[model samples]
Target: MKNIQRLEMETKGIALSQQELIIYLQENGLQPHEEYNAQSPSAKKAIYQTALSTLESVANNPEMMRNVKMDDMTVSEFHENLTDRIDQLEKKIRGMRTDANQSDFFMLFN
Candidate 1:
C-alpha cells in the first residue's frame, strides 16, 4: 500500500511537469512542426522520447539537483517570480510593437 501511494504521487508529479512543459511551449509558439505532427505514431514517439531523455538527463545532473535544493523559495513565491518576469517581457514586446508602428507612420509622412 505504501509503495502504491508513493508511485501514485510520483506519477502525479511527472504529469504536472509534462503539463507545465506543454504550456510553456505553447506560450512560446514552440508547437511541433506540421510535418512531424502528421507523421506516423513511431515518429511522434521518437520525438517525445528525445524530449523525455533530455529532461531526465538534466534532472539527474548533480549541478542541477544542487540548484533545486539551494532554492529556498516556496512554490507560491516561485510562481510569483515567474509571473513578474512574464509580465515584464509582455510589456517590452508591446512597447517594441508601438515603436515600430510609430516609425512606419513617420516614414509614410516623410
Candidate 2:
C-alpha cells in the first residue's frame, strides 16, 4: 500500500488533522500512498487496515492524553505554535513546487 493512502485512511478513522497526519507519516518514515503502484492491491489493503487500527488505538490511549495537557498551554503559546506550523506548511508547499519544476526541467532537457 502507498504510505499516503494508508495515512489518509488512518487519519479519517482517527479524526486527525492534516498536520497531525503529516507528522505521523514523517515520524514513521512512510511516503504518500500515491508513491505506490496499483499492482499490489492486497498489500495496500493490509497497510490501510493496519494503519487505521493503530490510529484508533493511539487516539484512545491514555498515555497520549497525559502527555498533552491542554490546560497548561497559554493562549500565546497556542498562537505561536499555529503561526509556526503555518510557516512550515508554506515552506513545504514551496519545496514541492520547486521539486516539480526541477522534474519538469529534467524531462524537457534530458
Candidate 3:
C-alpha cells in the first residue's frame, strides 16, 4: 500500500488516505486486518506488477481512447500521461529486480 501510494503520488500527484485505500481494497476482497511487511520484496513487487498491468490495460484500450474527457484531460493528453507513467513503473520494477539479483549474485562471486 505504501509503495503503491508513494509511486502514484510521485508520478501522478494523486494522494489517497489509508481509509480510502482500505475501502477500495475491501471491494477487491482485501481484509482490513491484513498488512504488508516492508521486508517482503516479493509482496511489494507483486503489487507493483499488478498496478502496471491494470494501467497498461487502460492505456492500450482502443475503444476507450476515442473522445474521452477525464476532468480537464483530453484523450491524447491522457494517453501521453499514461505512457509516461507506464515507463516510470516499468523502470521502477526493473530496478527492484536488478537490485535484488545483484545482491544475491555477490554471494556467488565471493
Candidate 4:
C-alpha cells in the first residue's frame, strides 16, 4: 500500500515491494500496528529494523563481504561501513523504543 512505499522512501536505499514487505514481516516475525503512518516513531522503528536486517544479511556473510572493490573502497572498509550502519540502526531503534515506552513515575514525601 501507500504506507509501504512511504516507508521505503524513508529507509535509505531500501526498496521493497508490497509482497516483499509482507514476506519480510512474516519471516522476521514483525507486525506493524494496524494504523501506522510513515512518520510515526513505530513506523521508523520498523523501517530501521528492516534496513538493519538487510544489511546484516550481507555483513554476516564473510563471502559476501569478501574482496569486492567499489572504485576506491576496499572490502574491509565496506564491511566496516555495513557494521557501522547496522550499529547505528540498532541504536536508533533502541532510542525509539525508549521514547515510545516512556511513562511517568511519581514519589511523594511527607
TM-scores of the models, in the given order? 0.30, 0.32, 0.56, 0.61
Instruction: Note the residue pairs that clash in candidate 3.
Output: none
Candidate 4 — what's its lDDT? 0.61
Alpha carbon deviation, residue 54, candidate 1 (Å): 17
Which candidate, 2 or 4, would have the higher TM-score against the true structure?
4
Could you tell me the C-alpha RMSD of candidate 3 in Å?
A: 6.3
Candidate 2, 1-110: lDDT as tens digits: 55666556434423455666655555544444446544454434434444544444454565653454467785456445544544554454334432124343445465
Q: How do the residues 1-110 of candidate 1 rate in per-residue lDDT, one tens digit apiece?
A: 22222222322323335544444334433343323432344333333333443345444454543444325775455445444544554454444422124443445464
The candidate maximizing lDDT is 4
Q: What TM-score would you give candidate 3 relative to the actual structure?
A: 0.56
Runs of candidate 4 with Cα error greater than 4 angstroms are: 1-22, 27-36, 66-68, 98-110
For each candidate, the alpha-carbon lDDT, in order, equals 0.39, 0.48, 0.58, 0.61
Better of 2 and 4 by lDDT: 4
- The number of the candidate with the highest TM-score is 4
Each candidate's clash count = 0, 4, 0, 0
Pairs clashing within candidate 4? none
Sort all candidates by lDDT, best to worst: 4, 3, 2, 1
- The residue-by-residue lDDT of candidate 4 on 1-110, one tens digit each, is 44445445544443345676655554544553344455566655666677667677667677756645578889888888878888888888766742355555434775
Candidate 3's residue-wise lDDT over 1-110, tens digit each?
A: 45445334333433345564455444433343556445666555555665565566567675766645578888789789888888988998876742246464445464
